[model samples]
Target: MARIAFILLCHKNPDAIIRQAEQLTAAGDCIAVHFDASADAADYNAILNGLQDNPNVTFAKKRVKCGWGEWSLVQATLNAVEAAVEAFPHASHFYMVSGDCMPIKSAGFAHQFLDAHDCDFIESYDFFDSNWIKTGFREERLIYRHFFNERTQKRRFYWGLALQQRLGLRRKIPEDLQIMIGSQWWCLRRRTIEALLDFVQERRDVMRFFQRTWIPDETFFQTLVRHLVPGREIECRTLTFLMFTDYGMPVTFYNDHYDLLLGQDALFARKISVEASQLHERLGGLYASDQMEFEISNEGRTLFQFLTGRGRVGRRFAQRFWEQETTLGRNRELMIIACKKWHVAKRLVAGIRDHTNVPAVEYLFNEEDAALPDLGGIETTLEKRSRHRRALMRMIFDHFESDRLIICLDPSSLDLMSDFFADRATVRLLEISCSFDDDYLAGHARRVGLAGPQTGADTMARLLPTIRHDMVYERDMMRDADFPNMTRISDTGSVDANAHAIAQFLGVSLETGKTLAETPHLFVD
Candidate 1:
């Protein structure tokens, strides 16, 4: 059996670490905990005490002080790996994960997956064009820290001055030259870990140069691996969750929008704080066994469809159909609105009525006498397009209730809705475009004064009608173009016109199980 190692850097929050460690231990994997020496000894002792029952867990010597944006943390991790290698020489592979990370897949499944891949799974990417400016700042900060070290601060300054004189230089050296980043956590083969350790020990000058660098955690492993095993089978991306943030600081798991992350097929998630209880509960029992058939739920599928560029109309149609046909009725209350368009809102109301058949109250903006609950309203100038849309959406989302469907007529209304609800919000955006086309093609456009000569001309020349006529003519032409084969026409008429047209042209179902009227306007332009 392949062996895996769980290396965690614990400072505070020992409970989370212990819980994770216990889960890993239950799967028959070895656990190694490395506490930062700078952390309180009482905390460390508490962590050790909790792990006393676990036979695989062990403590390492050579404690190091880990500072943010410094090389010390990576050094400490390397030291722990060294210890694990010494103790488990016969082990096949070693996986590195953080205390904050939780496995979405079972250990047996994860082990088998890793065993199949020969490459190291560390995320390494060129930082020059990416959003890695903070990495450069951290590097400069580390240089300053090293230059001003208390004991050798003056000696280092004089040595730098002497070196500058020897090189005939007057100005200070430029610091922000080259920077690269790799994820701090990774899983490596036992031989790979030994190779990295040997490389570090042999290349003292390189290690010393990196020691005074900022955010060395991002570069240390990358530089070593890239030099040692250039062009080897290494995964450029980490199997981790994409973090959501505000002002460069982690905010939440983006759980309110779990659909966004679920589509990515990531192997792990990180920095999920304790408040993401709903996300935790939803993800629980996701991949509990190796033999378990992994299938996304209907809700998961609907969310993925939206994420992959299917607009709100498609999502609502799929969701309503799914709910009626499947056991996903329990989560029907989750509502997500992408934008607030007045017409879209009306369709949303219509869709809700069609699916649930519930008696829903309607309120118009100008209807002062309409009996309705007090929902907040927002006003924005037409000149401020983005702001106007944002404000309208916010107001609509604020008034939205899971039990009651909120219809927004304006696409601009989705702007604010996106902010309040996560990717998982059950709120579906109704396609106003589809409804508009349906109304216009079915002669309702003239009543709304939107149908001009140009509108009628455009619909008459559309592809759906042309294709439908072409198919009919082709069948007749094949049968000698006479009225003798009129029986085939009856058979074709029994076939769903919309379904046949959509299948022949678009290769998808136009009908949503609950049929809408057969109108040319409902077809995509």
Candidate 2:
């Protein structure tokens, strides 16, 4: 069995910290806590009273007043690690976690996994090579000295930054170390930790340089570990499950996400919501045996896809419709089937799918779930209001095997449709006119209730003009003269006939049993 020493950095929530520490110690793992010196006296006393009986729990003698994006946080961690190393001399590894973090898996499983790897699991990536930092200043965080806390004293932080820029003053980093950055949460071998402590003790200039550096907690250990440990011994990935939003804010978990967290490959989850007592109760004492083979779940992938669709790119695309509509490129093989009534358009899409082998779906921008693969996250009212149509289109195009896609358009989405097809030079738009009776129109009008009562002809007049089409299947004789690219469906009334017409329009022969791959003209020219 691998003896692990957990270094916990706690601030508030005494009960929660007690539970976490007790759970870890219960599993034969020792814990050393560094409660923030700035925290309430009552909370700190409560923690002491709660865990005084546990022999495995130890507290750091030297406490620091920690602040966000400050060197104090890293110093606090170092104090706790030193206390842990001295207390538990048999400890093989040291895992650092925040107060809000909880283990999703059993301690036995973690020990097993760590013993198998035998290397440090910490996310260390090149500071400049990848787009690792999301919101704040990246290279500037190191080169310039930041005296004010960016979160608390925003005005002072900016003023200090401007003053530095005016004076052309820059801090020189230690030549021996390459500045690497990653998640502050990490698990490292005892030897690596000892080497890091020794390196920090010897290098007084490094301490002085990082003391003024911005957010040194993230870069301090990450940069130093690379310098001390060999590249082969470092895994360059954290075992903790940490995810951030587009604004670089951490994602907090609640009670409902129990299954999602349980299914993840990560041993620990960070920054849990304080209100999640039920989540704490469930995962608090839960431990899996070594005999149980853990199968990695798809929940992580699903959650990742969900978060990706709501990320910065998705939000930007969503907001674009308000300022100016973006013209979609016809570089990919895409087809649009528009009808006044969604049911008729859905039926046409069904016929297309039945006859041809091309990928087809109904309502790519429906208010409900999108008919594309893995788009369940785009269903909220804010998501719909943001008008993430282009993002949806991109996902639809990317989901299928090839770049070809056939989508049915709801009449409600005509404005979005028009925006996309405004500069349509290559995309094939097949518009099918549907006849809406008086009853249907009145029901729809009652449901909508804009300014006045609407009739069937009034509805048709409003919806028909926005559709851009290369070909028209005039099912309703009332609008036969409305389209210049008219192909009368009167000649082909049957589903099979209409299917054949669509297949021929797409350059696929139904009689010869040709697939989309065999038809080169549709995709190429």
Candidate 3:
């Protein structure tokens, strides 16, 4: 499948944004989105919650303070473009669209359309002839100083205009660059975008001049397309259809406009309102998913349509980022349970993740472990009981599920095996033991970023296994640690030998499963 990177700029209505993202996305396709800096916290979190299922979607880490009809809009769009480029290395074609935009055709059709074309699809026309800025008035865009804070900046605009009218104080457009204007949207090839990004980086003087220009985004990419990549294929038409009024603002599409939109040969349609339920239903009915997404369509359309009307956001199902990210389901191959022995537990979890990366959870049983719930000042016995042990079990059951080897570090956790076995959290619960060298001290562990203030007896690692473990790893003094794991691993071949023992205990060969093959990487500093 061809990789396409989608950069979507959104301010409100995360439901519509989520719908648009899901429809445009498939395997190997990535979506990069930038929410307006002033966007509501709940709405922003809703967007993240909605897209949590899609690993391909990435948000800009640095948000741009967007201002409408000013340079900040372009800045936010540029940030989204840069983020997409950084995140999706496989993406070759880049599509920049708006949050209100929706795919009118199948994803395959859009993919095939881009695959058939070799050049970028950015449309532009000479600003002098387009009449978008009234021919002779086109120069007003470059000469005027448009302030980003639109409300209070109105007086500044008028004052600047008066100053220019009286004293010719307006800024001059660069002599080397020609201004162009068109539909402020495009689908471009990767090389063209990278070149454009590099051009902006090299020519900040041009950006500084344009930052004060009226609606710079209107002229920014359009001018660059003409100046930087001349003689390239220009479509001169946007993929999104928008009907405009005499005043030059886009008219809202209603149910009546659905037929017209369906007949048009475009990939997307913009500014659809949720109040027009029939329109959304018709659109979803036409472009549904492969697995018969009528239900998804109905749910998404219902929520989107309702939200579009009042701008109230809702997801039928939602969870916090970590909760949604690490939720477990059985019918898998391996499950990791890391309790109090955080040192060995951390390493073993890393080893399993490196080998298979199957579903796993690293539960810290030690009250000393930072992951454990806080036990701050409980006066009553019930309160004390609820704070430490009860909360941990509740958390464990909530995140627990697996079909493979369960590596539990704390023996106290093994006492709750009946709780897990009842839920079938795993097909089989394996007892694993960890033993560190006697020479190892708590101070040594502290130097390596582990928790401090211990007498270094370290009986927990050796004693936990004897109670219930079926396999024990006699981890010799640490030496060969993975760079990601951040421990110096031994070069004396003890790790390989320990891996061999693990394989032997499991009744599997070192050559049979990737588990042993991947063991060294966990400690291969």
- C-alpha RMSD for every candidate: 20.6, 13.6, 26.6
TM-score of 3: 0.52
State the displacement of the C-alpha of residue 496, model 2, in Å, after optimal TM-score superposition.
2.2
User: What is the lDDT ranking, best to worst?
Assistant: 2, 3, 1
Query: Each prediction's Cα lDDT score?
Result: 0.50, 0.70, 0.58
Badly placed stretches (over 4 Å) of model 1 are 127-131, 134-179, 254-264, 275-291, 296-433, 436-525
Instruction: Please give me the total number of clashing residue pairs in predicted model 1.
Output: 29
- Given candidate 1, what's the lDDT at residue 390? 33
Q: How many residue pairs clash (N, CA or C atoms closer than 3 angstroms) in each of the candidate models, in the order given?
A: 29, 0, 12
**Full ranking by TM-score:** 2, 3, 1
lDDT of 3 by residue, 273-344 (tens): 767777776665455443221111112122223223331133122233333333234443333243234555
Score candidate 1 by lDDT.
0.50
Best by lDDT: 2
User: If scored against the real structure, what TM-score would every candidate get?
Assistant: 0.52, 0.68, 0.52
Candidate 2 structure quality by residue, lDDT tens digits, 1-525: 788899999898898899889888887899999999999989999999999999899999899999999989999999999999999999999999988888888888888889899788887888878667767688789889989999999999999998998999877778888989998889999999999999889999999899989998888999999888899999988888867765667888899777667656788897688899888777776643333455454245434443354212211112354434443445766677666566665655565576667788777565355444555665344355236666566666666755667776654344454455543424565655444444554444344331123223433344333221211222222143243322222122554555455655565776532342233222110
lDDT digits (tens) for residues 139-217 of candidate 1: 2433442433323355864465457557764332224324456777677777778898897788776677777655678
**Greater-lDDT candidate between 1 and 2:** 2
Among all windows of 10 consecutive residues in model 1, the one with the lowest summed lDDT is: 483-492
Stretches of candidate 3 off by over 4 Å are: 134-137, 148-152, 281-525
